[model samples]
Target: MSKDSETPEERRERLRQEEWKDNLGGNLNDSLNRGNNGSLVDLVGGLGWKGTGILIIVIVLGFIVYSVFFR
Candidate 1:
């Protein structure tokens, strides 16, 4: 049915579906490209496999440093 002939509920549903289709993968791509520095989720999402590996190595080294010096 044309948009003008649709009931309010049907129009809302149709628009919602259209919005979802338009934004498909857009949010994921945006989040991956523009990660928030303060958010761990964003950080991990933004970092691909290699970056995540390096991050894990850095965390391990940092923990070792703290253990050796702070304790």
Candidate 2:
């Protein structure tokens, strides 16, 4: 069957498998080692440098916009 015809449950399962496959580098249970000793930086290690940079920029810009316009 085509992906368009997939049920919601089937679609979710397919996406979940794809994400784990891509995220875990071939294995499912292997997780990132954030050796920052359980600090907030550990969150960034999971996301890596690029993702952390983008996230920080987005958050800072969003906060600035919100403070300027919404507050």
Candidate 3:
């Protein structure tokens, strides 16, 4: 089929292949098997103090706003 006659799905599949690579940069299997991969220290410390603080403040503000406006 000619380029102009290509279906929408064919064009999308071609572009998606170009945009997204199937290759993994490193060994995902080895990383997941590590014991501490999903620990609480990893979870909390990943956010750092500043990020955690800001997230708490934002959630508090959201709750306040919801209470005032919606309830």
What would you estimate as the lDDT of candidate 3? 0.66
Each prediction's TM-score versus the true structure: 0.42, 0.40, 0.41
Kindly list the per-residue Cα lDDT of model 2 for residues 1-71, writing each as its tens digit: 89999976577668867877777663423333323245453466568679989999999999999999997
Give candidate 3's TM-score: 0.41
Clashing pairs in 2: none
Off by more than 4 A, model 3: 1-41
Local distance difference test, per candidate?
0.74, 0.70, 0.66
Runs in model 2 deviating more than 4 A are: 1-39
lDDT of 3 by residue, 1-71 (tens): 77688876576556645644554443354346546466544455568678888988998999999999997
Separately for all candidates shown, the number of backbone clashes (residues 3 or more apart, or on different chains) is: 0, 0, 0
Candidate 3 residue 1 Cα shift, in angstroms, is: 64
| Index of the highest-lDDT prediction | 1
Model 1 agreement with the true structure over 2-30: per-residue lDDT tens digits = 87889765765677568767897875665
Predicted structure 2: lDDT: 0.70
How do the candidates rank by TM-score, highest first? Answer: 1, 3, 2
Off by over 4 Å in 1: 1-39
